[model samples]
Target: METRRDLRGILFVLVVFVGLAVIWRDLRYDFNFASDMHKAELGRRRETITQTVTSIALQTQIETQTELTTEIVKLSEDVSPAEKA
Candidate 1:
């Protein structure tokens, strides 16, 4: 009877250890998944910010070029009349 009781105790301890191991593995997997998702989100945000800055810079350059062209045309017209006189 004592030997049977010892066997049952050993079996119970083994089962408990297996359960704990499975729980630990599942928790580790969940943590890794969350970390990867966070990294991906950060990458997307950086790309969007870079694109917006580039677009703004291009727009400003175009506007400045247009203003300069208009001024040059006006100056040319003024000179043409004076030359004809």
Candidate 2:
């Protein structure tokens, strides 16, 4: 009867230890998940900023190109018709 009581005590302690380990693992998993989610959001924000800058740069290039084209047209008109022929 004494051995049986000792065995029961050991089993109860083992069960408690296993439960604690599971709880710790679950908490660790949640923390890692949150960290990864935050990193992803930051990456998305960076991408958006990069895209906006690129768009602005492209718009400026287009405006400069248009101005250059207009100047070329004006210079061509200034040339004599005989020179064009």
Q: Which pairs of residues collide in candidate 2? A: none
- Which runs in model 2 stand beyond 4 Å of their true positions? 1-34
Stretches of candidate 1 off by over 4 Å are 1-34, 81-85
lDDT of 1 by residue, 47-81 (tens): 55555555555555566567668878888888966
CA lDDT, every prediction? Answer: 0.59, 0.61
Query: What TM-score would each prediction reach against the true structure?
Result: 0.53, 0.55
Q: Write the per-residue lDDT of candidate 2 for residues 1-85, one digit (tens) a residue.
A: 4464456556556655655555555456555764777656655654665565556556655665676688789999999999999
How many residue pairs clash in all the candidates, one count each?
Answer: 0, 0
Which residue pairs in candidate 1 have backbone atoms (N, alpha carbon, C) closer than 3 angstroms, thus clashing?
Answer: none
